[model samples]
Target: MADKTLTSANSVLLIGVTGLYTVPQQLQGFSEDDMYSMEAVDTAELKMGADGVLSAGWIPQIKTMGVTLQADSDSNTFFEAWYAAQEAAQEILYGFGSVTQTSVGKSYPLLRGVLSSYTPFAEAKKTLQPRKFQIKWQTALGVPI
Candidate 1:
């Protein structure tokens, strides 16, 4: 009974997880008419050197769900190569459900906060900035029983 479509890349991955859990609380609740229609364009002379410091970029935020399923593409390349082959191996063992262990034991407890490095790339789009978020969950009778 869970029929869903919602594409446009799933509405840009649900607006990148609601702008990565709300843009740093909306830049710390800025007010006074939001700093008078906001305009502060002096990015230190556009952050020069080293190709404008790699094009003067910034976007950081992340909170684990194993770094959002390792920046999913159905969890790191098609359900992890069909959970490591054997001819679609019972469809990746009934579509991934039981592989757990993390009290620092680590056996894919949803990839342990994406291999932990204090995850943040617009809240775990796996550190590829310029806005990022991704999600793809499928069951519709692909077994979860």
Candidate 2:
């Protein structure tokens, strides 16, 4: 019988990005129903591979540059704001530098997973707050010799 050791592995690459915006006064004018009726924009979609890897695709938009309130609730509103911020950050980090388009079809290593954190609060209120998400995987981006 052959013995094998089971060890946990952590991916080598973790990327993250972020955006910020002040809540607009116009939003206050809308009634609760109107506010809820306002369609929440779809920022990002995540896909997972059979191997338990994850990848995310998102529509790039300038308006999405900042966080926005989702609903009138301490929890939901906070969650919506945080969710947008995290997605925006991820989009920036993934789109940064000259390296873009990370997919299995491109011969890149299989994506491991897309992990994100959500925080709700006024950006100005939190002077020392961190707003970013990271991807975990094992691979390098560069020309091979």
Candidate 3:
């Protein structure tokens, strides 16, 4: 029988920042939708000429990655602190991170990542909602471990 692949077990997401948070730590406190999602901002644009000619222009854009975690997660607190430090810094500090799916032996790395957007906090009457964090990354295709 062929080897059974395609598993999410033993996957981890880690983040780090220079001078502030140099050590990369695993981000926990994830919600049910804990999978990290990545999407390309734009692909290629194509046009057809009147004389039945075709032209295409490929635009290289940053990839946007998003993750959802519980509001009360320690990971959220770490992110908040990281953001605060960035805001208090004299210069911008980009984040360095990586996500590895050990089961598949595939890893996605973020060379230079910017925390594009995130919800500080949100709460209902007696319930805590999950917070979403979006990151803009300049990443290439996933490589083998």
Candidate 4:
């Protein structure tokens, strides 16, 4: 049988105002999805004109990505500091980076973006759940091996 384990996976996040912040660990992946997922900001739409003509149009949307990391001390500290910095700076500190799923031999490019949302605190019964955040990136295309 093949080893279906995630051997080496990491998400390297590079902030514009600061520097690179590498999450040196596997992400919290969904049961029926990839480790990292990309979603469009707006879906394409089709409109019917008065003359029964179909017109399709879509806003040029820069894809957004969802990333989850273990909410350990390190992650909590780093993100807290980052959030504080962003708040103090009073500016949109965008970022760019990549996610490498070595086991699957696939990589994703994280383009210019900022942390759209972040979960500062969440707790369970004697368990530190992963911290899920959203990144609104200009582009996030998958590159298969």
How much does candidate 3 score in TM-score? 0.85
Clash count list over all predictions: 5, 3, 0, 0
Worst 10 residues of 1 by lDDT: 10-19
In model 4, where is the ten-residue run with the lowest total lDDT? 25-34
RMSD of each: 20.3, 17.5, 2.2, 5.0
TM-score for all predictions? Answer: 0.16, 0.19, 0.85, 0.66
Q: Which candidate has the highest lDDT of all?
A: 3
Candidates' C-alpha lDDT: 0.24, 0.31, 0.79, 0.61
Comparing 1 and 3 by TM-score, which wins?
Answer: 3
Q: In candidate 2, where is summed lDDT lowest over 10 consecutive residues?
A: 6-15
Native-structure RMSD, model 1 = 20.3
User: Taking the tens digit of each residue's C-alpha lDDT, what string does model 3 give over 21-78?
Assistant: 7988799878775656887567888899999899999987788888788877888976
Task: Give one digit per residue, the lDDT tens place, for model 4 in 36-100.
Answer: 45675666778999999999888667777775566553545555655777888886666666676
- The residue pairs in collision within model 1 are 61-120, 61-123, 62-120, 62-123, 66-114
Q: What tens digits encode model 1's per-residue C-alpha lDDT throughout 7-124?
A: 2111111111121222111111111121101112222323467655534455333322221322322323332332344233432222222122222222221111121122232243
Question: Per TM-score, what order, best first?
Answer: 3, 4, 2, 1
The Cα error of candidate 4 at residue 59, in Å, is 2.5
The sequence of per-residue lDDT tens digits that candidate 2 reaches over residues 1-145 is 1432222121122122223322211122112222211123556888899999999998643211112232333333433553565566654222111122233212122122222333344345334332322232223234321
Q: In candidate 4, which residue ranges exceed 4 Å CA deviation?
A: 1-35, 40-45, 103-105
Off-target runs (Cα >4 Å) in candidate 3 are none
